[model samples]
Target: MADSQWVDWTKTTQSKNYRGSGSFATFMIVGPVCFFLGILFASFPYDFPLLWTSDPVAPSYYDQLETHLRFVHQSPPLIARLLNIIMTVGFLGFFIKLFRPSEANVLFDGASLVLYVIGAGVYIANIVKGMRAVSAGVWHTEDFKGIAHDGPLTGEIVLGREDSLRVLSASNTILALVLVGVLVLQAGQWYAERREAEDNKKADQADKEAAERKASASAGSGGSGKKRQ
Candidate 1:
């Protein structure tokens, strides 16, 4: 059984925009990154991980190439989408847990959701088809530049119709615009919530002060208002 630790999904860890660029960005950016690296690997299998060392911490080799495709790239689109859906859930958790203030958060949540769906659709297709081509030697794992390669690679890779991919690529551009919208909305919500909270706090303080003043006046006046004459 998997680790039984409980996880909460409501507390955001980063900005809504941070989460927006999340899964979609991974599929959008890294999908192509892998293709490029796959090409590099196809062309120079020995030097694959050298050129693409990333920031803060380096990307794992399996991550660079997409480890899941090692076996399941042949499943139907629905099945792959199922896998994509599961992973996207985690991506969303990253968004919800860190993203707060609902202003940007909700908007990004929508964008992230859309990204998860669309990007996953495209990526899963590409990965499955691309892997077949690669395996058949049509797209050399090291065909980074495609300048040199034995004819062992199959034609599906070299001559594959990537027009659908172009359409799929639109998911990134759309998600990016949505992320901006999310940021704007998040700011608005933050400002509104902050103002409301401040107003409530101030009102409570004012009421307390008024009560204290009333008590002080009553005590000072005592019962000898008319000098007891």
Candidate 2:
């Protein structure tokens, strides 16, 4: 009963759009995925068999794992890339809310699901494409061969595939930017909503105070009338 009244009041005052809920949902989903990716990239080289390379500073295994460096799959990618995945779930939540905007979303948080799944999908696809460079054996930019240092012994270690990797990175960057921009817009909406709620609360409180003042004055006049009679 008390819960229902509080809920009813919230429904009347707040916007039915629950898209904002997704922002936080995306945050949770993206967090784990990025953590996993961080571990994957950080550990993959060490776990794989030893590869002998002459480059003093660069670890041979690290150079070899470069075969898997993707624009949206590395440390930098983990940041916004993971976030966008979570945002996808949030967006989905918004879509569902349109059908039943006022309903309680206690069990399933749809917005988070949509944003997270979509964002994760993007990261997966891009990362796989990066791995493809190795399987294809073209030794393209992401291919370990491309980044290998050139010297008297190894002539342009990657053969010749700079343009391709640059293009792949650029394309993936665009995808990330699109998803991140959507999240940023969501944040803006949340800020606006919070402000609106504050204003409404203040207005409601003022109205209640005015009513109380009026009632007090009316009771005082009635008591004076009785005394004079």
Candidate 3:
């Protein structure tokens, strides 16, 4: 069944309206990549500490000279921002692929891509804001106040704390959800096509079998009549 289904799929793909293999492969691959990137972007802020602090037991964190000097402290925001840039480009790629001619649900794809752009835009803004705030020697604490910390804090700040980073995290989640919907809609279209091809093949086989059986029965009847004469 799988092999026959593959044959049917190959035939459908060979149609003039079907795009080339490159677009087809990208259509399948890029969506999930965007989704994973969304998850990474959403989770990264929580994993990194915003407060700059050296002392583990310190109650109040300050923006110490070492925080600026230490590359390790700055790496998290830098890395996150870089990844955000990559994912932003990924969203563009997804958008382009979504708009390409295909048999999938175009309306759903277009809507999903629009939501993706909006969500990614919000996320990018949040990350840029964080990077800018860190570079300026100020950290937006979980309570929403900007604090000047001496070193990076180990405690995790949950997103949505009335801060711009909250917007970033929320947008990432929204984008992920939208991408998932796009996947579902595309899958639905593919499944429908596959079922249709299989049904057509079945109908053709049934017709051929009926014709062959009628011919065989007629041949048997003619032979009996000759023998009886």
| TM-score quality measure for candidate 1 | 0.35
Q: What shift in Å separates residue 161 of candidate 1 from its native position after superposition?
A: 6.2
Superposed model 2: Cα runs more than 4 Å off: 1-99, 102-131, 139-160
lDDT of 3 by residue, 92-181 (tens): 655554443443424434555665566556545654454454554334344345433333775444333224334544544565565566
Report how far residue 108 has shifted in candidate 1, in Å: 8.8
TM-score of each: 0.35, 0.46, 0.50
- Tens digit of per-residue lDDT, candidate 2, span 140-174: 33535535644657654443343444434443454
**What's the lDDT for residue 29 in model 3?**
39
lDDT of 1 by residue, 11-114 (tens): 33333333333335334433433333343234343222333334232446433343333344455779756555655554555345333323344444445445
User: Poorest 10 consecutive residues of model 3 by lDDT?
Assistant: 57-66
Query: Residue 21 CA error for candidate 2 (Å)?
Result: 2.6
Better of 1 and 3 by TM-score: 3
lDDT of 1 at 183: 44
Task: Find the number of clashing residue pairs for candidate 3.
Answer: 10
Ranking by lDDT: 3, 2, 1
